[model samples]
Target: MAAAKGAGTKKPGRARRKNRPSPRERLLASATSLFTTEGIRVIGIDRILREADVAKASLYSLFGSKDALVIAYLEALDQCWRNDWQERVAELADPEEKILAFFSKAIEDEPEKDFRGSHFQNAASEYPRPETDSERGIIAAALTHRQWMHETMTALLTEKNGYPSESLASQLLIFLDGGLAGAKLTHDIAPLLTARDLAKQLLGAPPADYAI
Candidate 1:
């Protein structure tokens, strides 16, 4: 039988369309990609919507507002790090070993997209003042991550390791930020490797040879 006129016709050269991701997944995937690839400050909400292929109404309904959505993204980012690196470091019996392991993970090559530096640090640099944005999501996210780092470092260094937690924690964070920046600029992990060695030295451990 001949195909009827106006019937659906399949062509060999036609491409199949992928099933659309759920609206929430689409939004997260799009926001993360754009924010990481370009920057949070530079990427606008409308652009995010377009990339997500979701309507403004959907985005608002899902997140309450743009700020809320960004906060969600930040939360996701934080949880990812905690699960990926911090949890594993907890397995070490020595608190000092835990501290070194923290920095060691940073230098180790994880299966991930090209290095663009820490997302929290990048957001902080882009939006240092809360006044810069009306909702202040960016500033809040940055502070949240920093507080976590402070708490973790303080616990390991002071409670178990018998070091001055306050000063050392601050110094370690400074080194972390510096190493992240240096790695992004140089496209080499040596800065982070060096930072780990410096951290060991600060803890009174003999500095190990750091490699690229």
Candidate 2:
């Protein structure tokens, strides 16, 4: 009777296996995970393929080459981050709250276990002076995201919040860059907290009392 009952039950594992991600999806997932945690240059295609359990042909067919894969990874990262930030601030009515929420999300959303600084920043540093087309693509992918963030913040501060100049937005960008570096160096969230407080002061928002 036990054997009969077991035979009648559907296998959850089989259902999950049937719904597994495609080869391209698997390759990107592996590349993003390894590249973010390890690095863009340090991790090779073999390692990504091994981790992804995918074939070389699939990678080439999907991404063309390793450099292309890196570009795709950065592009995906950029999209996910911007989408998440927009979603994070969507419901908030206050423009200042929306601005401050960016910093808050950085602190609250990201896990510290294997935290690395911004993937874009890391990739840009890894290829300091881009020479090849692929290198340029990689750097462009990184800078484009930063540029979008800068423009968005500037518009919010100057146009929406009645800030006199765009300089405040630039300063806030610097603060965020410095804070990310500090947090990456120290493996702590203190720097992010400090950055948020500083941003609040700049925005003339109510002061937060955080000791870091």
Work out the TM-score per prediction.
0.78, 0.85
Per-residue C-alpha lDDT of model 1 across residues 1-212, encoded as one tens digit per residue: 35674366665444333455788988998998988779876888899999998999999999977777877788888888778766777567787787777677777642154568778878767765567353486678767887888788878777654544676777887888787778877778889888888887787742231100
Please report the TM-score between candidate 2 and the true structure.
0.85
TM-score leader: 2
Per-residue error for 23 in candidate 2, Å, reads: 0.7
Which segments of candidate 2 are over 4 A away from where they belong?
1-17, 163-165, 205-212
Best by lDDT: 2
lDDT of 1 at 141: 75
The per-residue C-alpha lDDT of model 1 at residue 70 equals: 75
Assess candidate 2 and give its lDDT.
Answer: 0.83
